[model samples]
Each structure stands twice: as structure tokens, then as C-alpha cells.
Target: MKKVKRTTIYDIAEKLGITASSVSRALNNSNQVNEKTKELIIKTADELNYKRNTLASNLRKGQSKTIGVVIPRINQNFFSNVIAGIEEVTYQKGYSLIICQSDEDHDKEIQCVNTLINQHVDCIVISVSADGNDYQHLQNVLDHGIQLIQVDRVAEELETLKVINDNVQASYEAVSHLIEGGYKRIALLEGPQNLSIFKQRKEGYLKAFKAYNVPVIEELIVENAWTKELGAEGTRKLLSLPHPPDAIFASTSDFSALGVLDVANAMGIKVPSQLGICGYANESFSEITSPSITTIDQFSVYMGNTVANLFFQEIGNNDTITKPKIISIKPELIIRGSTKRNG
Candidate 1:
């Protein structure tokens, strides 16, 4: 097959009987070229299907005008919403984004960062995977003089720009709501403790019980119950105990809470009456579930918008000086049928 040649400024210049330098200035909208000549050059360039090489153009300005985003899963509602939010602002700022999914693998996360660095992306926004123990990949980004931002799940040890949800407070509110609804025995389906967010959520659960003077049942608290299958298994085990919990806080995700609800149905237990369910992330299906689940709304899209806007505000001005910044968004409790035992 014959290769189609890309249209360049030289081609436009040759068609117009002018030097390539004049065409370059006209395309760049530099004041050195007159308006009439610029108009003619643009028109001819458009007719020739000319497209500016953004990679080369950004190199000249010492910027890529591009951002790299790394998330665990693109199909998940929370991460996808965040990406949409980032794109909304980046699009208007004349920037582009290169997105990657680590699939919750540490090695893949490192590879994604290295790829972004090699591409010379101006900034990198990441939500570390569950296995992201060593943060040398992030340090490498800083060493290369690239801006780094962490969202959702961040490494607290690293000082960088971060936009995250207040997991502790949110979990506190969710558990507190269950307690207020007159639940004495509340079980917690927790995530991996290594991740800061899960640890904070566990802290919040414990704090709520402490505040209420309620003794925590050690058997009720399950570890690594982050997935639907695990949540179902945990629920079965908890419900089978001699002194079973009347409420469960699936603090890991709505998906886990969903598993609890499914198992409860199969076991002939009623939600909010026999057992209340509260989940995190307030996934869309939470509202549609029978006896819709009570959950915490993380404002995922707003979090994403905040990340993008923060980058533009801090770095878009071309200021060399920058300081470590942290923005924490407060999540709200959406009390639905699953946890409304009293009302």
C-alpha cells in the first residue's frame, strides 16, 4: 500500500510561493506575520488537511501540556467519574491526558509511571494500587521534574499534591448512623489494612463504638472482605455466629455490601429490620437495590474536577515555586432503606 504523506507547513508555503518560516509564524499566530497572510496560510493549510504536531510543539515550550492518569480500574464508577471530571477542565486548558490502569498490581503501576515519564507528560495523577508498597516509581517522576498528584488512595508518607476523601469521618458517619438506628452488634467488612484508606475506615468504626461505649466483638470484624464473594462468605459466617450482628458496615465498597444483601435474601433475613447494611462509594445500584443500601457518597466527579483545577491553579500560571498541598473532601451519608430501621 502507498503511504499517505502528512501535510506540513513547507507544503503550504510551497503552494503559496513563500518561505517555510513565514508559514510557521502564521500558523503559530505570532504577531510577526500580518493578519491577511495568516488568514491565507490557515485557509490553505486547512485545505491541505494539515495538523500541528502537538508533541513537537510542546517540546519547544518546555511543556507537554499533557497529563497522565493511573487508576486501578476504568470500568469502576468512582474512577470513571473522576476521569470525566479531569477531562472537563483539561480540555478547556488545551491539554491532553494519557490514561492507564494498573489492575491493582504494583509492577504494572511502576510500568505505567515509567511509560508516562518516557512520554514526557507534564503531570501524573495516580491512585495507588493495593500492592503499591514501594513508591520509588513516584519518586522517579519527581526526580524527572514532573508534577505528581495522588487521588482517592494516596501514600501518606509522600509529600505531593493530593485530593482525597475523608474516609475516617465518612466511615464514622456510616457506622454511627447504624448505631443510632438502634443496632447493638455491628459487623465490619473491611479492606486490606495496608492501604491507608481501609485503615482509616477501620479506625472510624472503632472510634464510633468507643464513643458509644459499645464493646466491639472481635469475631464480627472480618479482614480483607473487599470483594463480593468474600463479603458473602463473611456475611454467612457472621450471621451463623451464636450472637450475630444486627447491622453490617461494608466499608470497603458498595459491591461488597451488595453481596451481603444477596446472602441475606437467600437466608430469609430482612434489611433494616433483621440486619441493616451500609456501604461505601454510594454506587448507582445502591439506590436501586431492594431496600436500597445506606452508603457514603464520595463525590467522585467533584474529586476529579478538584484534582484538575488544582493542577491548573498551582502550575498553569508558570510559577516555578510550589508547595505541598492537600485537599480533603467530606463525604455525605445517604441513608436509604437498608439502614432505616427506625424511620
Candidate 2:
């Protein structure tokens, strides 16, 4: 099959008996061009199906009007909502977005960043995956002179515009909530400690214990139990101990908390009576659980909007927003039946 050749500005200009420069200026809506002539040129260009080459235009302008976003998993609700928020703000500014997922692999994350760089994206937004450990890939982004924004799960060492929740403060509040409800022995279903988010959450739990004068039990804490299966396994191990925890904080996510709730039910432990459970991320299923789990609402969508607007503000104002700026959004704890111990 023969390929259809795309029409160009030169073709339109020849057909209209005008210079290619005039056609180009008209297509770009330049004010220097006469309104009537510009309209005529545009009409002729449209008739000829002249489509401007964005790459050539961007090269001439010295920057692409495209932003690349990298996420661990695009299918997750939180990340998808964040992407939606980013699109809402970026599309209105006549910018394009390119999305890619790392699938929780460090190598893939590195590859994704390199691909974005090759594409000449003006900015790159990312939330590092759970398995990512190296920083060279991230450093390469900054070294290339492109704007980089890190959101949610981020690299702690890199100094960039970071839109993140107040993980420590929020976790402290969640732990304190359980204490106020008279749950003394609390078990933590912790995530990978390498991530700053999980470490901060652990800090909050410790701080709350110190504040309330409750003893922190090492035996009650489980490390690297981030998924539902891990949560369930950790819960089983903890409950089988001589003295089981009266409450569990699924700091990894709500899905982990759901695992705790299921295990507790199977063991005939009454929720909010014999066992209290809390989770993170405010996942939709948290509300629909048999006994709704108390969780932290990270305001993922709002965070995305904040990130997109931050890029625009820095780029539009030409300000020196140097020194790896960090913006922390406070997260709210949603109290539900799972953590309500008494009337």
C-alpha cells in the first residue's frame, strides 16, 4: 500500500501564492501577521491538511512542551487519580503528557527515565517504585537540565520539587488515635524500611508510644510486610504469641489492613473489641470492609494538582526555585469502626 504524504506549509503557501514564512506565522497565530492574511493562510493550510511538526517547533523554541510521568503502577487507584489531576492542569496549559510505569522495578525505572530524556521532555514527574535503590538514574535527569518533580514515594537524597504527605505527622496521629481508644499493645505491619515513607511512619508510631507512656514492644513489630499476604502471615505470627497485640497498624496500605482484619476474624477476635486495625492510603475498600478500617487519606489527587501547578509556576515565572524544594501536604486520618474501641 502506498503511504499518503503529509501536506506541509510550503505546499499551502505555493497554492495560496504566499511565502512559507507568512504561512508559518499565520499557523502559529503570530500578532505581527495581518489578521485578514493570517485568516486566509490558516484557511488554506487547513484545506491542505497541513499539520505542524511539534518536534521541529520545539527544537526551534529550545524546549519541548511535553511532560513525562513515571509511576510504579498505573493500575492502582491512587496513582491513576494522581495522573488524572496532572492531566487536568497540564492539558489546559497546552502541554502534552507522556506516561510510563516502572512496574516496581529499578532497571525499568532507569530505562523509563532515559527514554523520557531521549524524547526531550521538558519535565519529568516520578514516584519511585518499592524495589528501586539506585540514584544514578534520577541524578541523570537533573544533570540533563530538565525539571524533575518527585511525588509520593520519592528518593530521599535527591533535592527536587517533592509533593508528599506528612507521613511522620500523620502516622503519629493515627497511632495516637488508637491509644486514646484504649488499645495498649499495638502491632505494626511495616513496609520496606528503605523507603522514607515507611521509616517516617515507624517514627510516628514510636513517638506516639513515647508521648502516651506506653511501652513499645519489639515482638509486636513485623518488618517488610507490605502486601495482603504478608500482612496476613505477619498477623498470624503476632497473634500466636503468648501476648498478642490488641491493635494492628497496617502502615504499608489498606490492603494490608484488610489482611489483618480477615485474619483476626478467622481467629474469632472481635474488631474494636479484642482487636483494632488501621491502614494507610484511604483505599476505597477500607470503607466497605466488614468493620470499616481507619486509614489515612493522602489527598492523592490534590497532591497531583499541586505538583503540576508547581512546575508551571517555576517554568512560567523563571524563578530560581533551587535547593531541591520539598512541599508536604498534611494527610487526614479517617476514623471508622475498626479502630473505635468503646462508646
Best by lDDT: 1
- lDDT per residue as tens, model 2, 95-144: 89999999989899999999999999999999998895788888999999
For model 1, how big is the CA root-mean-square deviation?
2.1
Per-model C-alpha RMSD: 2.1, 2.5
Query: Going through the candidates in order, what is the number of backbone clashes in each?
Result: 0, 1
TM-scores of the candidates are 0.93, 0.90
Q: Which candidate is the best by TM-score?
A: 1
lDDT of 2 at 229: 94
Deviation from truth (RMSD, Å), model 2: 2.5
In model 1, what lDDT does residue 306 have? Answer: 98
- Candidate 1 per-residue lDDT, tens place, 1-343, comes to 9999999999999999999999999999999999999999999999999999989999898999999999998988889999999999999999999999999999999999999999999999999999858998999999999989999999889899999999999998888888888999999999998899999999999999999999989999999999889999999999999999999999999989999999999999988899999999988889999989899999999999999999988775675676688999999999999988776
Query: In model 2, where do residues sit more than 4 Å from their true spots?
Result: 1-5, 10-26, 29-41, 319-321
- Give per-residue lDDT, candidate 1, residue 24: 93
